[model samples]
Target: MEASKVIHAIYTDDDVLMSAVKTVKAEKYHIEDVFTPFPVHGLDKAMGLAPTRLAITAFLYGAVGLAVATVMMNYIMIQDWPQDIGGKPSFSFLENMPAFVPIMFELTVFFSAHLMVITFYMRSKIWPFKKAENPDPRTTDDHFLMEIAVHNNEESLTNLLKDTGAVEINIVNKDEDAH
Candidate 1:
C-alpha cells in the first residue's frame, strides 16, 4: 500500500489553532490529530470526537473498591477477630459500619484513582520505556500542531491552513518500512 501523506500545520496560539480546526472541519477535511502545549477547552468537540467514557469506568472502580472494603472489614473485624470496645461486644459489620467509613472512603478513592490511571495508560497505548511518538518537540513547549491527512488536495489545504494563521506548514510522508 502507498504510504499516507499528512500535513502538520503549526500555530503559536491556541485560539488560532481552534479556529483553524473549525475551518478545516467545515471544509470536510479529515483531521488526524492535534497537539497543544496546554489543554484547550472544547477542542475535542471541534474535532468531532466522541465523549470519553472514563467517568463510568471510574464509578465502577469505586463501586468495586467499596464492596472490597466492606467484605475485608467484615471478615477482619467481625468474623476472624471480633473486638469489644466501650463495653460493647457487638460482632456485627452493620453495627460497626460507622468506624469503617474512613476506610471505605480511602479505598474507594485509591481504587478509582489508580485504576483510572492504568486504564488511561492502556487505552492511550503508553507504557514505561516506550519511545515518544511526537512529531515535533516544540509542540510540547509553546507550539500547537494540527495534523490533517492529505488526499491529493495539498495545495488547497496548505492555502486554507495559511489563511487560518499557521506559522509553519510541513508535509510529512510516513515511512513505508516503519509501518
Candidate 2:
C-alpha cells in the first residue's frame, strides 16, 4: 500500500500544545493524534473527543464481582459446608452477610481494577512486546507531538502550525508495512 503523508507538530509545553489544538480545531484541521510526556488536563475536550465510558464498565465489573461474591459465599458457607461460629449455626447467607462485607468490598475493587486495566490495554491496542508508534522519541521526555494528516494543503498547514508556536514541524510518510 502507498504511504500516507502526515505532519508532526512538536511543542515544548503542554499549555502551548493545548492552545495550538484549539487553534487547529477552530480552523477545521483534523488532528489524527497527540503524544504527550504526561497527562494534560482538558486535552481530550479540546481535541473534541467524546467522554470515556470506562467508568460505566468499571461499575458493571463491580456489580459482577458483588454478585459472584454473594453466590460464592452462599454456596461455600451455607450449602457446600456449614460451620458453627460464635454459636451461630444457622446456614443463612443474609445472617452471615455482615461477616462477608470485607470480602465483598475487596473482591469488587479487585475485579474492577484488574478488568479496567485489561480493557484499557485492549482498547488502546497496547499489548506486551508491542513496539511504540511515536514518530519522535523526544515526546517521551519533554515534547508534545500533534499529528495531522497532510491532505494536499501542506503549505497552509505548515504556516498555521508555525503561527501556533510549534517548536519543530516534520513531514512523515507512513507506510503500512512500516508497522
Predict model 2's lDDT versus the native.
0.93
Please report the TM-score between candidate 2 and the true structure. 0.93
Q: What lDDT is reached at residue 26 by model 1?
A: 97
Superposed model 2: Cα runs more than 4 Å off: 176-179
State the lDDT of candidate 1 residue by residue for 63-166, as single tens digits: 99999999999999899999898887649888889999999999999999899989999998899997777789998999999999898999999999999999
Candidate 2 clash pair list: none
- Cα error, residue 40 of model 2, in Å, equals 1.5
Q: What is the lDDT of residue 94 in candidate 1?
A: 89
lDDT of each: 0.91, 0.93
Error of 2 at 22 (Å): 0.9
| The candidate that achieves the highest TM-score relative to the unseen native structure | 2
Model 1 per-residue lDDT at 53: 94
Runs of candidate 1 exceeding 4 Å displacement: 176-179
As for candidate 1, its clashing pairs are none
Model 2: how far is 73 from its true place, Å?
0.8
The ten-residue window of minimal lDDT in model 1 covers 170-179
Model 2 residue 119 CA deviation in Å: 1.0
